[model samples]
Target: MDLIRRLFTAALVAGVLSGTAASVVQQATTVPLILEAEKYEVVTPPPATAAPTTTAPAASHAEGHQHGPVREVGEGVPVTLDEAMQRIGLTIAANLIAGVAYALLLAAAILLAGRPVDARRGLVWGMGGFVAVSLAPSFGLAPELPGMAGAELELRQLWWLSAAAGAGVGIAALAFARNRLVIAVAILAAALPHLIGAPHPESAEGAVPAELAARFVTASLGSAALFWAILGSVCGWLMSGVVEPAESRPALRVQPGAR
Candidate 1:
């Protein structure tokens, strides 16, 4: 019994330590957002002119001054640092929320399975949740409507990348933990975003300029999927120790002449 207890404790400790290390590495390696500015031009109105009413005009009354409309001109679009920050913030927030949701779902699954709650099971549940939430949406079973063009387009643009990233991260986590549940979770989580699709574009009439929009969506989804998969795996592994097994029994031994 003591030996078993020690083994369980060691598993919990190792899992947690590994998870923490992975998280630190992830944060350290996160890609930073780069901002670039584009220029644009603004047209100004012409200056106002005043003319004398009389035919002679009183020999050209005192010279009058006229001011033309002030216009600001630039070559392309101009974006400020603040604008870039806001966009990055929105993207980060969205991914964080999605990740949290995935983790919660996994926890619920482990609980539902009636397994002895332990760090390992928690890790499994977490990975499982990531997979289910991320991958389940890809079945083309999602609802459809005529006016949802924008949303549809967004999904097409982002889902593939997201799914791929998620799968990679999931695989990494599984390998690190040596857990089947974790592996499964990684695969599913990586694939989930593509399955669900991103928010559609606003119009079918070229609102986002097809090619650019597609690339953006694909990159965004892929990055998000990978981020969440890694997050789920780490968190799950960290919490694995807390769960207890469902059944407990004493080791059996027989003595001479014992039936």
Candidate 2:
């Protein structure tokens, strides 16, 4: 019971701190690249019409600002400082929640393993999370910028989930399962997702420039990596501090009263 309480406490603390760190890293790296990608989306030329004009369509000032809403905000978002602040706050909150969720998963896994949890092992688990969630799915989907056209949302989501599940299960089996046959099954489970292939659009549309898209993908992946690292390290450190000593302490024996 004491261990469980400490586990929860550690997870909460780790989640909040790691999530804040992720947000800061995102703001510094990913956010700038996304903003740049948006610029390209704004500038993309409209597809040619079947009506077939001998001359190019006249570009207007409005064309330069393609978003149909406030120039300072996303389409349909109001241009208000308060709204912006609210959005920022919400994003940070979401990040914190995600951090907590991952931390909980890591904590549970460690407990199940019945092994000593420390910063190093926690970090390994964090890398597993990254591989399962980010790296695996990316092989198929890569990353996309706003306004980029791609596969149907449902199909893409399904594929991404499959990939994550496969990789995660495979990694777990490989690490934990003692039987060779079980490990082989795990390997197959992991490979199956990639073999099925990622869903693709009927046609690739490049609304954002290729270079910008590439940069954004790299930055996004980097941010995720950093987030996982911090979360794993913090949780591991805290959990170890609480659990290890308690586990190793010798049991106390009471002697007969000598009143």
Candidate 3:
């Protein structure tokens, strides 16, 4: 029970810090690109017969913007300071939640592996996470901008999970396995998801420019890398007793009292 409590405490702290950092990175990079992409998002118009008045189209367009791509602010409308702050707050909150979840998982893995974790080793573990979760799946499905075409959300999600899991297993095997056959199997496991391929939209066309999309993908991956790095290092440091030297101290010995 004590170990569990300590583990959770470490995870929570690491997660909050990692999430905060990730939110900053996203606000600076991905958020702007998403706003730009929203400008080019394609919205289907209401049929002419449904419109009783000329103003209907305008109303319909506004409604479309509200429903599309999770963008709360209206199109062509300047975002107020309050709205911008609200958006940032929401982003940070969401990132924090995600960070906590990730930290918990990473911590569990470390415990299960039964390896000594330190800040330096944690960095390597974090990079391994980046490779498993980001780099591997990305080869099949690069991160998409708001306006970009994509496969059905469910399908994409399914593939992403499969790829991440496969890559994780493969990474663990490579790190721990000494047998030649086991290493070969690990490589195959990592490759299997990509070989099956990711689902894609029938048409590749999208309103957002390819250059913008490329930038968004790069920024997303970079930010993910940053998040994992912080999470791993902080979790390791905390769990390794470096952050709580008193708690980690050995019990003091009582010497025989001199009369």
Candidate 4:
């Protein structure tokens, strides 16, 4: 129970701080881009031969306008206080939750590695995480903005999970393994997802400008890297005090053979 408490405490602190940072960064970088893209999300007219009763086209247009759960607000309309607050609240909450989950996972890895923890080491691990989770998968699927085209959600999600997992496993093996065969396998694992290829939309048409989408992807990656770095460094700093290594323990002193 004590061990668990300490772990959770470290994770909670790291998560909150990192998550707060992520929220602020997102607000500054990604939020405005998303809003601008949403304004361009007006439904494109269907082909003349397309059936009017068919809803697939309309559904696709509607889904394309959303980056996530947030509803669309119209252009030139004033954003109400409540609505703005809700968006902010949701953003913060989501970031916090993600941070906490990531922190816990990092903590577990650190424990398993049984290495003395410090900010520098933590930062390295965190960067590794960003590469595996964000950078690697992103090669295939860059961050999507509102009014952007993408493959089906389910297919994308599966590929993302596989890519992240493979990259993480491959990285870990490459770092620790000594055997040549194992190293070769690690390289293969990392490359397998890209080899399989990510699903893509039939057409790459999108209402959002190419420049905006590129910016969104870059901002998202930068934000993720920042968040992970913070979470890792903080977690390591906190955990350093939680689990005392044998070498770090103080030596008992004898007072001139007074025993």
Candidate 5:
């Protein structure tokens, strides 16, 4: 039993370590591409000029007409590819730590309650954690798309698809592993938000009246929920091996008249 426990712990630790490494590698590869794109062009506005004076009456009349207030579009802060990549890496690391902590807490709770938790249940719990954590940001902030307008914003479709794929993978992994009830519950809990739907920014005040915006918001939320649920499930599964299952006693048979 002690050996088994140690083995499980080792496996969980290894899996988490590998995942962290992979995340680092991914950031390293993508950051350069992003930087190259940003460096391709630099836009500089022309110098300011004084208003030309009109000589003719007709010219004076046209020049004197007042125009509506010009909306001042502020220049956005420039983030180099390396900086963006570093930020992403940091975010991933933070989330990974949080996920692992949550998984450990859940495991401890189940053990304290004298319940036998398996890999499957751990995954479910992970998913639930994902949903719970993601909710605050999803509703509180508006979606922003810099450098994208009209059809270009369709790039969001990729995000949705990726999310769906992640959820599907999580479900499949659980089914294959045949995890326990608790894990199943966690997975479902994590997935509920995506299925329940997200608050649309289009419904918020000051949004443009485009039909796609509403759909985009809804789909994006749904997709993200799915993706995170799967991700959490996988992480939980990896960590589940670390927790020891409660021992079951063998049934005793009494011989006739034996005390």
Candidate 6:
């Protein structure tokens, strides 16, 4: 119970800090690009050749738009305060939740390894996570804007999970296994996904400007980097504080002739 409580407490603090930082940076960088892309989401449906009784709205999904749950807000008109608040609030909430989850996972892994959790080690874990979860996957997927078409969700999800798992294993080998043969295998393991290539739709098209898309991609990566770094640092520091440091333990002071 005490362990659980401490872990939760640490997670709460780490999550709040990491999530807020990621959200703010994302807002500053990626949010605007998403808004800009949404302006193009008002697609007119293909002419109804089938029936005159068609009750479908005059506007339907754009040809290039991939169906998904990502919210599209940028219309021609200015955004209302309420709408802005809602979006911002939702973003904040998402960040907080994600941050907490990542922190909890990191803390558990650290404790499991019987290693000291400190800011430096946390930073490494966090960065490794970013590499495994974001950087490697993005090499193929990148970030998509509204109306961007892609391969089926299942395919993407499968590849992503496999890639992450592979990267994790490869990294573990690189970090822990000392043999040259092990390192070679690790390199191959990490490179395998890229070698096979990520699945993509037949067409590569989107309504968003190339420049804006590029910016958003860069910003998203940057924000993720920031999030992981903060999570590691905060979680590490918090956990270290919660547990007594090894060096801080009272050293055995032997008196002369005590033996």
Q: Which candidate has the top score in lDDT?
A: 3
Residues 1-259 of candidate 3: C-alpha lDDT, one tens digit per residue: 8889988998999999999999999999999998788787655744446546555888978976866644232353357999999999999999999989989999898888777788998888888998999999999999998778898999999999999999998999999888989889888988898999999999999878999999999999999999999999998988784233454558877789944
lDDT of each: 0.45, 0.79, 0.87, 0.86, 0.46, 0.81
What range of 10 consecutive residues in model 3 has the weakest lDDT sum? 69-78
Q: How does candidate 6 score on lDDT? A: 0.81
lDDT of 1 by residue, 1-259 (tens): 6534543444344434434433343333332211111122234465445963554444433323244334343344445889756855664554445455544444444434444545444455444443444443333223222212335455554664465467546655654557788777777776666556555545545222344434433443344345444554554454454445545545577999988
Candidate 4: worst 10 consecutive residues by lDDT? 68-77
lDDT of 4 by residue, 1-259 (tens): 8778878988999999999999999999999888778776764443454554556977867855653333343453246999989999999999999999999998988887777788888888888889999999999999998778889999999999989999998888877788989988988988999999999999999877899899999999999999999998999888885656778889998899696
Q: Candidate 3 — what's its lDDT?
A: 0.87
What candidate 1 gets wrong by more than 4 Å, as runs, is: 1-77, 116-131, 135-203, 207-209, 246-259
lDDT of 1: 0.45
Q: Give the TM-score (vs. native) of candidate 2.
A: 0.78
List model 2 lDDT by residue over 133-247, tens digit each.
Answer: 9898999899888767788899999999889999989999988899999999988988887898889987787667788788888988998898888888878887885545455
Q: Kindly give the stretch of ten consecutive residues in candidate 6 with the minimal lDDT sum.
A: 62-71
TM-score for candidate 3, residues paired by index: 0.82
Per-model TM against the reference: 0.39, 0.78, 0.82, 0.82, 0.38, 0.79
Worst 10 residues of 5 by lDDT: 144-153
How far off is residue 10 in model 6, in Å?
A: 1.8
